[model samples]
Target: MSRVINTLDVALVAAAVIAATSLLSNDYYLRIIFMMCVYYLCAVGMNVLVGYAGQKSLGQAGLFAAGAYAVALLTTKTEISPWWALVLAAVIAGLCGVLIALPSLRVKGPYLAMVTLAFGIVVEKLVGEWTEVFGGAQGIYGIRPISWNEQPLTTQQWVWFAVVLCAVAHVLIRNLLHGRFGRALLSLQADEIASSSVGVRVYRAKVIAFVVAAVTCGIAGALVAQQNQYINSDFITFHLSIFILLLVLFGGAGSMYGPLVGAIVLTAIDAALARWPSAQHFLYGFLLLFALYAMPGGVTGALQTCFKRKPKKQRLSTGETPKTTRIGPVASGDLLVVEGVTKAYGGVKPAQNVSFCLQRGHIHALIGPNGAGKSTMINMLTGVVAPTSGSIKFLGQEIADKPAHEICRMGMGRTFQNLRLFADLSVLDNVMLGHHTRMRNGFVSSLLGLPGALKQEAITQARALELLELVGLSHLCEHPAGSLSYGLQRRVELARALATEPQLLLLDEPAAGLNPQETAELGQLLLRIGQCGVSILMVEHHMDLVMSVSDHVIVLDYGTKIAEGKPVEVQANPRVIEAYLGVDDEPDASEIHATA
Candidate 1:
């Protein structure tokens, strides 16, 4: 059904372009149509980076120049065919994308934007000042245009060619962005830490997004140069970069049709404003500001709001049991071993000399007062924070220095102390993202939407639905995660973590915001999970839930382990009492337990 819809959309676009080409005889209208296709290509790929991945870039013009210049040099100087030169130009621009993406790993937000802006400035200067190769201000002339057989394409034929490319690009990009890869990008935009916890390689995903944007923008640049039979540094400017960004923002960033909408509407507006050169910059600036503040989601978003439909309530059938499956590597006895872990920042130590072991199929609780480092310990176990000195062994493999995504793939899953749900995504999508590493399909398989990829996606969705049922959230699976109540959002996070199929689960304050009744339900849920052969380690402040569900308990005080034993033993320990009450004298056992 989705394939049919996608085909219909492409067909409609092609039909419209064909109709316009048949009716329009003027060169100006034909050129406008051609430029719209080019800009749409750039906008669609930019949407993947700036829209879905949330990596703001301001140097795409540099990548555009990389493509445009490559084609100009290749067709003018070498014997390479214009078509082959176009492909090579895309490859060259993709490499440039990698160069720009390196800084993104170390910087973000305005700092990352500045880095890309500098790159554009450098490329502009290099092209404008370098005389021998780039032709300086004189620019490259008589560049060969693409041909059909032995004859160069007419203006109408060029428009037809661009329209076909746009159709193909739309189909391919839609396929690429609909499944696992799309969810991964959206998850990264929502929360990088959470994205890694769900098995997304953070840096790798960013690079792929940058490459996607670069390749499409490169194609657009190559097409422009080939059509015009000329290339100049004057065409590549900061204004071009800003204009490309506006294409995404004004049309609706992450929406599938945003590129087409932006390209058509803004291209027409630009053509209309072309006569008033002095007002063009001012109008563009005003539109950009309006898009940012008034229509943040862009034109598509506003339309969605105006025509939104009410979602139907959905639920699992009565008495249907959720299927339970073994997650991670099958192991016996101890599943996680932490030895003498210490994490210190300057004179402040969050965790010092913390040591503990988690037995397979057992539920262990880490309990502490405020600032006792329970969350820090969980962070270290999940590889979110590197310990100053420690050894972490999961399933007998040393993983102290492994990245978070690596640890997750090794069958460790965790939830944050604070909620980190991808708010814009549906609850089902959040869970499906957790199954990212488990899917067997490669990038090519996913990009082309092969049968294997489709099958795996179906299996992932089925598994996610079952997990939602297990957590009593199947009814709300279609709703946005952020729209759910606090307790429901917690359940969604748990379901998402469970989808990772981890042998060991580390939960930080899972019961923090729940009422007493909800806390009890959560205790029961943890027990059910433990019975499925998964080891559990939770950092929580609710003593009632801890006492009821914990098989063993470790208590922390001022960055040090104060007690480790059965829950009853830890609850009655004098040191634990003193740590909680901050008093030298031992309190009554019941009083200490109540205080905790």
Candidate 2:
């Protein structure tokens, strides 16, 4: 029932509902609905980037001003149509978004906030100082109201126009939020490094989000300029930017209705408080603080949390799951070849001349002490680092220099040494985040909730559930990954990597800190994952686990592959024993067995 109600359809229905209410009401109510429509459009754009894309913007108001001025100046000074001005304003604002994001990409956290805040101030100052085109502090006035030929728009026409713009913008953004691009943005919020490792161009995704958001704001600005019949720089002040940011946060950061809900609720409150202007802002401040402290997820998010449902993990296959359509020994020869892959620091050896082969459908273990460069080897294999001198080929393709996400899209996936879940999001969303690269829906269709995106989501959710079940984590699907136990988090991480559906899965320290029982379960899980034909390169410190499962073991000693062979043969090698100080006095084979 809920899934059937979507952006365009829902927005149309909502507009109809608002229209019905206004049809039977007085002029006052119509005006209120018009204002609500405008506010909702602005909030929708704010939510797209700051909410869905995981950016914290402080310059949307500046973009809004740019659009308003574009329309004002174009109409007052030239014969340009308002429609063309709106288009030009959108382009100009989008260009500003690109410029702001290019520089903001390198700076994050408070620095990111500061940069954007400064941009808003700078844009404001420029609008005030550029006396040639802009009217400085006086602002451009006498703007012509838009209308059909021979007459300006009536109150009813303006209200309807407001309804249409709001409805259209909402539908557009909603569709975009559910597409591949949306997932990419979510992946950034979830774990940027992991997202990049999965083939998401983080910078590109971010910039696109910024531009989309800016353009949406520009559209809203055009509508506002036409409605008010006057424009001023003060209208797009710093406070307005912060208000929109807080509005997105207050509504719900990752939901279709969050922005609309936030805008409506706040506007209603402001209207009610208009009689007490002195205390109104103070009250808003209090509410903002209260919401942050008591309802951080906002009304929609909190309600969802209260009644959240965990998606069940699919049951494990009985007997055996089907392997990749090959009857050969797991990971048949030379599909993944890393030869003489060497990476070292200024003076310390990190990974010295490492060489190995991973055939498809095999489980390959890379085991070593803390400083043995196991992580480095995994990094190099996944293209997280460029080898000082060496090569890595996946399916006979040189993937050594490609970024991590490209390797993922090329059928390589990985999990980190530490858990990197979106601490704020649920387990289901975490796996969903991992499916960004695999999803086919683009932003436009997703935002529109076209039949294509709906079908695609149904497929994605079903696949995500299957992946969850494969890793035995379906039970906690709705719980935040951060709230799960260490063992469960490890499995969820594995589930996330599975979401990418990679041919080669690289796992770093998969069994670290697990209890004996959990470790046994992990061993079984790894064997099972390998049986599904995912060639695995894993780093583990547990010799017992490695010796039991690894068909081929690469032993690293202080960042160099000193030994590589079947676990049995490598275990018995004299140099391998001495590397671990087993040769103070040489330990016999029997003694080594006894220690094990």
User: Highest TM-score: which candidate?
Assistant: 1
> Could you tell me which 10 consecutive residues in candidate 2 have the lowest summed lDDT?
321-330
Q: What is the C-alpha lDDT of each candidate?
A: 0.90, 0.77
TM-score of model 2 vs. true structure: 0.89
Model 2 lDDT tens row, 1-596:
34456644766786676568656557766666676776677778777787777788788788788778878877788888776777887788788888888888788877888888888899888888886777777777877667688588776777787777777776676567655667678778777888787678788888988888787777677777877878766676777786777677788877778888887888777677778976776876776786678887887888898998865564634535333322113446666888888887788778888788886767888876568788888888887777888889998899878888788888888888987776766788778767777777766677666777777777778777788777766667878788888888998888888787788888898988799899888888888787777778888877788888888988888877788899888887777777765465667644443343
Off by over 4 Å in 1: 316-325, 328-330
Off by over 4 Å in 2: 1-3, 7-13, 20-32, 272-284, 302-331, 423-426, 473-480, 589-596
Q: Once all C-alphas are superposed, what RMSD does model 1 give against the true structure? A: 1.6
The C-alpha RMSD of each candidate to the native structure, in angstroms, is: 1.6, 3.4
10 residues in a row with least lDDT, candidate 1: 319-328
* Predicted structure 1, TM vs. truth: 0.97
